[model samples]
Target chain A: MSQERDTRTAFMEATYRALCTHGYADLTMQDIADETDKSKAALHYHFDGKDDLFREFLAYLHEGFAETIADHPEGTPVERLVALVRRVLDPVDDSADQQFNTAFMEIKAQAPYREGYREVLRRFDADLRTEVADLVREAIENGQYDEETDPEEIAEHVLTYIHGTWTRAAAVGADVVAMREHLVDDLLDLLVDGASVPVDVDATEDRGLAAADPDEPHENSSEDVVDPR
Target chain B: MSQERDTRTAFMEATYRALCTHGYADLTMQDIADETDKSKAALHYHFDGKDDLFREFLAYLHEGFAETIADHPEGTPVERLVALVRRVLDPVDDSADQQFNTAFMEIKAQAPYREGYREVLRRFDADLRTEVADLVREAIENGQYDEETDPEEIAEHVLTYIHGTWTRAAAVGADVVAMREHLVDDLLDLLVDGASVPVDVDATEDRGLAAADPDEPHENSSEDVVDPR
Candidate 1:
């Protein structure tokens, strides 16, 4: 039994590597077999087909995330939540993990018609929201946050931040690790400080005029405006 | 010359409809031709191929966005920014536009190998940041906001929030319009009131204990957490 479980684990690892190196659009079972040095028949025997393989892969990802959050050290709920975000955005040297994530998203985009894929993605998203919400509620209860705090709203915000950061980072080729660090810091800042302020009318007017005529091309006005990081 | 332009316009309109019904992944030039009721020869005569069609579509999208921004009524910078975000979140109900945006993201995920796609996407992202930053700076200069404000950082944060919100909304089938309204309100709150506060310790302890063990599933203890929306 142990040996059978080991083979399945080894297959999943190889499959993940292959999916990363060669995108889901291009991946084939033969490639997985070669990567794992297992017979194609052996792969078929363990999993029904490519879809099955992907389903299992997603399961592994969710399980891993749950395990990581479960093992986080005892600390302020905010600290623990930050740690969770870091783990999700953890640095990876190879493009495999990154590619894997992108591929997962692509598959998700097709989920309206792909019921199985949709189910898996929904569950994963729910799991993330629930866990984050729990942490936020705990923080509020412990008086780490204001008494009137809303956990669901905050959880949604954090989840949105994570998704947005991942999409933008992937889009721009920015260092994922650095981007994740910056995001966590900003999120923490927002949660603690809360949003309420006086509007800056003059600044608002200037920006309004600038974007007024998108066709009127303006020279890059300020060097400092560029993202230094 | 007028006839040629009209034909081009017609082709673009037809192509847009087809794209909305069928995503970019399933899109083909032949389908575009069929949708537009133009012969394949006509399409070939006007543009190179699938890649060419996509390129032209992107150019149109950028122009459309610029035009929309330019045409918006004069308003406070925050109001204008809010308007821009609204426009982006609301799908035009035009097939071509939806397909184009979807394809744009799909291509973005695979951008490492597509120089043309990367070039356009980079400029688009940079422009969004610059536009927002300029607005924030102008607001500060006009004394609408505190002098200690960092317009660039705030701009990036706002842009990130928008992008993240839209992506998740698309993934989960959320009402884009409703989400946009909520987002604008939340963002305004955050901007007016900055994020910074002391940590809550007691809430931290309860959350830590609950999340400490993955093997032990805890019953859902908190029912007070409700969706803010």
Candidate 2:
């Protein structure tokens, strides 16, 4: 059983690499095979075809995303929320991350025609919405947000912003860095008392803003109070 | 010249009907031809292939969207903004609108891989952004919004919400009518003095809200003070 799980992980990683390189429209099993030690026949033995492999691959991607959202449980509700947005939107490396996002969106666009793809993408949306809603609930309980604030509404708004930013970035190569800053600021300002909370995010953290071009104007410079590491 | 223009309009409408039916991924010249009085060979005579025809099709779609945005210039900035959101998100018959949206998003998802699609989509984004920004500027000039308010920022945020809402509605069959109501309320409350703005949207207008199920609860019913038309 352990060996089977290991092989599945390997194939999923190979698919990620291949999809990032070739995108959804042109990706093939042979292309994914080139990224792994396994041959095309090995890929065929494990999954029925590209669609079958992609269904599993999308679920695998969602697993990673859900785990990332769950990993930081030690912060205030606002802090954790900011951290979650960073994990998704932080341009760790512009090219590879942007490539994956664009390709992933291409697959999502096909959801209307593909049941397997739609099911997995629905899981992604539901999981993210629930997690964000739970955080908002916690924030309200902690008195960080107003008692009247609807956790579900805030969750929907936040998720919509994230989705919108992703679509624009993928389709038109929009400046994601700026859009992410707006999200962070909106959360800090609207959802909570901005001055009372410590909204700092570490520059050297996984988002890799420390690697961003130093010359570019960072509008939300106040949020970068220190390297919290 | 007039005859050529009429032929283009006929083909564009035919392509729209076919795309709304077959969607972007499986759409072909034969499929498009079936919707038209013209033969498949006639479609080939006008355009080279699927991509070429779609390039023209996308531009045609944008032209219609642009005209719709420009049509309602007589209302208050806030009213005009609400009208635009309603036009996009109001569920006329739900099924047909949702089908077109899902298919449209699929094509948008391919924009990263197809420069022709990307160029046309960029035009859609640019034109919409400019229009929204200009409305913001108008509102600010008229003392409806704060003098310090950033027009460009408001425009980006509004556009992001629209794109995000479209993506969710397409992928998950989300409740777009509710999402659009939130947008209208946000525009009324945040951008303008909500009490002063007569936020009336005609139910019998092009948005076709009168066609919606009457049993559903309308949360922002206060905005429905009267239908002037």
Point to the candidate with the largest DockQ.
2
Tell how far residue A225 is off in model 1, in angstroms: 31
* C-alpha lDDT of all candidate models, in order: 0.58, 0.70
Tens-place lDDT per residue, model 2, A1-229, is 6988888899999988887888887788999999999899999999999889988998898898888667764567766776677666665355777788888877877777775888888888788888888987887788776565566766777777788889898877787767776666555543433423453433212111022232222333334431232
* Model 1 global lDDT (CA atoms, 0 to 1): 0.58
Tens-digit lDDT string for candidate 1 (B26-127): 777888888876788889999888777766766666666666544443455544555555555664355454444555556656665554665666666667
Q: Model 2, residue A93: what's the lDDT?
A: 54
DockQ for each model: 0.15, 0.32
For candidate 1, give the docking quality class from DockQ: incorrect
Task: Please write out the lDDT profile of model 2 over residues B1-229, one tens digit for every residue.
Answer: 6977888788888887877788777788899888878899988998999888889988998898898677664567756766666765556355666778878887887877775888999888888888878877777787776665566776777788788888888877777766766556555544433324543433212111022222221433334432222
Best by lDDT: 2
Clashing pairs for predicted structure model 2, backbone only = none
Position B78, candidate 1: lDDT: 49
lDDT for B15 (candidate 1): 71
